[model samples]
Target chain A: MNLYLGVDIGSVSSNFILLDQNGRLYRKLYLRTLGNPVKALKDGYASISDGLDKQHGKIRAVGSTGSGRHLAAVLLGADVVKNEITAHAVAASHLFPGAKTIIEIGGQDSKIIILRNNIVHDFAMNTVCAAGTGSFLDQQSARLNIPIQEFGDYAVKSGHPVRIAGRCGVFAESDMIHKQQMGFPVEDIIMGLCEALVRNYLNNVGKGKKIEEPVVFQGGVAANRGLAKAFEKILGLKINVPAHYEVMGAIGAAILAREQMELSHSPTRFRGDNFVLEGNFTSNSHECSGCPNLCEVVCIKRDNEVLAYWGDRCKKWESSIKQPRDRLKVV
Target chain B: MSRVGIPRSLFYYYYYPLWKSFFADLGAEILTSAPSNRHTVERGIELAVDETCFPIKVYLGHVAELCREELDYIFVPRLVSVEARSYICPKFMGLPDMVRALIKETPPLIDITVDLSCDEKCFQKDIIRVGRLFTRQARKIQLAYQHGCEELRLCRSLASQGFTMEEAIKMWEGEPMEAESETDLNIGVLGHGYSLYDERISMNLVKRLRAMNCKVLLPEHLGSEVVEAEAATVPKRVFWTLGRKMLGSALHMSQREDVDGIIYLACFGCGPDSLIGEIIERKVRDNKPFILLTVDEHSGEAGIITRLEAFCDMLRRRRNYRSESKLSPYGASLHSFENTV
Candidate 1:
């Protein structure tokens, strides 16, 4: 079988997906980024390789997305690189062709994508505020001494969800503490927090955006049934969560890779499974004193040869590596 | 000869040459605060009011920098209006006072109220008023004003002909002109001149768009008459000069078939932009693809670049598909996935 690989390295978590030529999911791995994406990528690849037998399929193409997309693409020789918005929108459209709106609440960021006929019509992402994200819930759940996976269960068991302030994280935390001191049930507080976050998401990220029917919710936060229930109730619409909710970005990237390869009719640049297992990777960065901008340039090396350099605003360093317009070769 | 300092912010982009020539003609040495950088923004954040927008904070930083230079007289004019029934922002109207309150031991300010709404004569009178501070001769002041006006006209012409403020200034100083190449995409960039032209403030937005093979059209490039004509179409007129220009240019661009899309660059926490951005968004929301990118000191480059790349990809794909299916009026249909759920 021919396979494709996609990796999404976000600030909070890293997700990986392996898809067959027929668009069938072969393996998925989700792990915490923990401020070390390079290590996370290596560990993810190790686990994915272990899951498949020795006679596993030939990896055809690879793609990467999220905040660390460039780093991942350079590291893995990805044929395609995309942003989280495109990756999410592509994945949502594939999962639900008729989806007009996508509510993606991830570990550290939340975004609302409006679509029309499978095209991304408009999008808005959370800025300067962490009032509506999974990380906020994770912090609250830890303080409440409940497992994050059980957060939605507690909300579901609530007989009456109380009103909690969610305009900002600090206010929400203090409000939750106040409510707890007043002896509100743990389930009620959890449900109230979920409702507040949903309301915040709608008011902020979904503000001024037309929320159409056939809405799809996907991300790590989609695992929380309580948030999904709150979203459905508030919007007065049914929300669809795909089976591979956590790894949708990776899946979308894989889909993008397939599309790119098919359009160009070029061979895949996949370095193979052994590339991650046996490759010796080292990285270094230096501030270029060439100009006043003082851009910090970073470069990756494989087996003592420079593969790629980025982070330069002027592209002076990046261009020198690809001066003659040659294809990226893996040593 | 006394030295005069000008804070390089806000209306500085529009009227700096006029002021520079006027000051030079008056025999005073002209000094300007440096272009905004990370240190400037940090200083502004430390000195400015918490509720003020990012640009205004940067302005305060410029003013503070001028204060440190100890110039004899700093020019902080109160720009009320350039046209009738339209006002500049309240911040511009009260800029001198704000600088006064923010900085102690500041140099004497050449604070003159310029209200051109009454008539064109007011502009001349305001110039004469500032010129009096340097010299008392009427003929000298008139000569300087004429020279200043001529230079201002040249600057405006160069700007409307698609030259950036920096490029126009360089050309004025006898710098060789660089050839402007044609590109496939015509993107209308609408924003305040300060924010749009300042590379550090906007994260080099125009350069990035150009690097992506887009021919950028700034609001200043579209003449004032064109902007005014388009602004009149809105139900309620935009009161702020820059706001009116941006909104008007956006409306004009939306109606044009050649302009692929509109990108509105706004500084975070700007009151006028918050309203103008919404109006422009509503006007062009259906007609063309509109991207409203808000920038602050805290915005990371990685996040911004990702959004920009995605937007560019979408535009490229749309343009390619439209051309491929030229026979169809609405173009070929994009594939939609089956609703598996």
Candidate 2:
């Protein structure tokens, strides 16, 4: 029972999925990444349980994606560690064949993917805009005395959505409070906020792009029906949210692992699950004075040949073959 | 008591008047190498690492020549930006740092700050800041800057009035050779400053393509005024400096039915060019069977010309059927690279 594993670790949460032959999933787990991704991997490994432990059920190849994919790959001995864009796009295509566009608003960033012939023709990412991301919505929800879980329901109930400044996060807050003082309904205000966020994304980041139809919206924001409605109104097109919308990145990564494993015809890079069962996997760092960006490169190694290296923008201290590229065996 | 060194390839070809005037105003002599020859290019590659793009390599080679002349300050403009929302490539933006790191030369570089990215007033303030680093006298620096600006204005205006560079040169230095054999195969070239000038890496395509009887029209040939005028058609109001220049060049070139084909010189690892170039290619590539040539330090001249020759051959046969090149039936003064018209 050869199986492939994929892990996506983010600032907010960590996702783990395992898939067997014919791309049929076996196990999947979503755990808050917290600060220490090492612990999250251990927690996920524990959740996957004893099924993968048997000699017959071998872990063939493992791939990692997300902000923490590099370190996770090193710990998990992942065969591939890809950037979020490729991982998300690959998974979206699999989930919805011939997916034209993927609008991903994660905890920290938002991305627009335009795909053609099951291939990504172009993509744009906006890490600069904090106002359009899920984290901003979370903060706004907390301030307005609205539970994040009920945000979608409240937004849909609005009669008249109030307009809020979407250019800056700070400005949006002041404008939001002003509307509330003016006797605007909470539901209406919430819906307005969602519309404003969508407007900001389209105006700033999505500018100059030809956003075609068959759109798939994923990441944490997919939970918000109000935002979905806002997008539909603005684009004049229906949007698709994959079944595993929140964890599509992880699911895509798992699919990549399965694809690579079948092609490699070798043993898995999944450094035994005991990697977590063992004591603290130690790491060290040093200042690489390559450029002005004095990247505090962290090198994680249990024993000798450095298992994983990260924290440098230029990949200064990255494991020789580079993060994701190292996953491939050229031989 | 000190001299200035300038690279002959890039800004030199166009900004020589302004740069030369600025140094002269500062009461300093100038030293620049002869037009790029093959050995100059080879030496440029030796001074620069392989990863740098074309213009950088030519710049390095120009620096190598300047090193022998024994100059004190090389006028390396931290050409930050020319306009808001537009910027030179990150490579150009980070050039001074890259040069200091790469070149072992002992001369301290005079960073002529041209940061137009910031508002004009602030950009001027930074220029003055760099000027203060040179001379203590305020009046002389201002005078030099004014004189330098006057020369640039004159260059731009002359280019605008459709004065043949030869005719305009007669106004400055007397008439030169009546451009021998006016019947050269006309072709339009679109690319960054570095790709066109850096002969070694961009494989010095202009001269080679010219030698093959093809007339090379550079981005500089497309006057800024004409580009700005036609650029109004773009709905995005995309005002990025290089982006505007690129689109303007493509649009202006597109209207010329006489041009057999267009060559878009692209650089490896350049982000803005990749995005904007793709946009232009999607729109204008099929309009005339254009070829996109990419260059890095490792690019071979042989491979480049082979592609160009293939493109020209395809053009010569008229076998390539693209949308008809846009030419007003009246032939209303088709755009010229050297002239705004």
Candidate 3:
């Protein structure tokens, strides 16, 4: 069997997925990044490939997405490195053919993608604010001494949700504390928090856009049934959460990788499981005094052999590496 | 010869050619602050008040850069209105006062008030007053101002010919500029000239777009008549000069066939931009795709790169699907999934 691998190294979580030749999900793994994507990626890869032999399948190609996509591409020889928006849109459209809207709220960012005829017609991401994202929810849940998995259950039991300010995260937390001091039910407060986050996402990320039916909600936050229910209640439309909503970014990347491989008919750039598991990969950054820009250039190395360089505005350091594959040639 | 300093921010992108020409012709050597860099932004943030917009902070930094240099005078103009019925931003009107209040030590400022709201008579008088510092001859000052206007026309022409204002200004100063290469995408970019033209401030937005095989279209590319006509389509007239120009440019681009999409680069705390950006977004919402990118002191390149890449991907995919629809009888096909075996 031929398997394509997809990796998403986000701020809060790292996800890995494998797609078979027929574009079916073969294997998936989700792990906490814990502020270190490199360790998470290596550990996730090792766990997914453990006990798998050459007779089982060969890794054909690799794709990466999310905020750390460029870093992921450098670590793993990725055939395609796409932004989260494109990856999410592609995955949603592929799974739900009639999906016209996609609401993706990840660790630190939320986005609304409007699709028309299976192509992205318009999209908007939260600008300079992560107030209503998964990280905030996680912080609130942790402060309330409620397990994140059970946060939605608390919301579902609420009779009336109290209004909390959702414009800013700091204000929302204070408002939640205020509501708690006022002796409001904890369930009602949780449900109020969910409603407030939904309002923020719609007003900020989904502003001025017409969101139609067949809306597909994904990303790590999609696991929260409260958000899905809130979205359905507010938009007055059914929210469809796919079976693999948490790893949709990884799945989309895999689909894009498959498409790229088929289009180019090129050999797989996969470094293999041995290189990923055993290769000592390290990265370091230094401020380049080359002129007054003082760009902090970062260098990634694999066992002392420099793998890639970036962060310079002039591309002087980036171009120093002559490897053709290091350059992101998006078609 | 008198040495005059001009901080390269704000109106510098728009009026640098005229200032350089007028000062040079009046027998004064023109010295502009070094192009904005990390130190410039840092110093600007340190010296400027926190409430001011990013461009104003950068302008303060440029002034600080000039104060370090041995100079006769620094020209900080109080620009109220450039044309009739439209004013510049309110911050620009108080820029000279702000500089005086903020900078600890500085050369004597040749702060001239250029208000052409009703007529250019007062502006001409102020121009001669500034020129008198360099030369006493009134006839010589008039000729120099005329020469400056001629040079400004040449620079504006260069800008309309697909060069950035910075490049055009450099070209006007006899510097050689490389022409843009062939591009696959036509992206219409709108923003205030100060923020848009400064490479450091805009994070090399135009250069990045060009590297991505995009031909950038700016408001300078359109004639004033065209811009004014498009801007007049709004029910209420835009009172801000740059704001009006941006709205007109955005409206024009939304209807242009060659243009794929529009990107508005706005400073986070700009008052005029807050209103202008919202209006442009609503006006161009239905006609074409638009993305509002608000940049600030944060220098993280990841968010910018991701947004640009995704925006370009959206435009390309939409274009491909539209073109594919033309070829097939069964409407548009999913190009990415066609070869899935």
Which of the numbered candidates is closest to the native, going by highest lDDT? Answer: 3
Writing each residue's lDDT as its tens digit, candidate 2 over B1-341 gives 66888777666544666777777777788887755655566777787777676567767777777777777888777776777766766667777776788778647887666767657887667657756755788777878888988887676555434332322323433344334245445787877654565444456676667656677665566767888876667777665577778778887887777776777877776677777787777767546656667676553233454355435544543422233443211111112111100
Residue-level lDDT tens digits of model 1 in B43-135: 888989898878889888888888888589999998899778778888888888988998888899998888877677877787787889899
Candidate 2 per-residue lDDT over residues A165-215, each given as its tens digit:
888888989998999999999999999988999999987667656788899
Candidate 3: regions farther than 4 A off: A325-327, B325-341
Best-fitting candidate, scored by DockQ: 3
Q: What is the DockQ of each candidate?
A: 0.32, 0.01, 0.49
Candidate 2 runs further than 4 Å off: A49-51, A55-57, A289-295, A303-305, A310-326, A329-331, B1-245, B248-341
For all candidates in order, state the fraction of native interface contacts they contain.
Answer: 0.15, 0.00, 0.44
Off by over 4 Å in 1: A51-55, A272-275, A278-287, A299-307, A323-331, B66-71, B104-107, B119-126, B176-182, B320-341
Judge candidate 3 against the unseen true structure and give its global Cα lDDT, from 0 to 1.
Answer: 0.89
Residue B282, model 3, lDDT: 96
Q: Could you give the candidate ranking by DockQ, starting with the highest?
A: 3, 1, 2
Give the Cα lDDT of each candidate.
0.81, 0.69, 0.89
What's the C-alpha lDDT at position A174 in model 2? 93
Clashing pairs in 2: A60-A268, B55-B194, B86-B240, B86-B241, B221-B337, B221-B338, B222-B337
lDDT for residue A290 in candidate 3, whole number 0-100: 87
Query: Per-residue error at A129 for model 2, in Å?
Result: 1.3
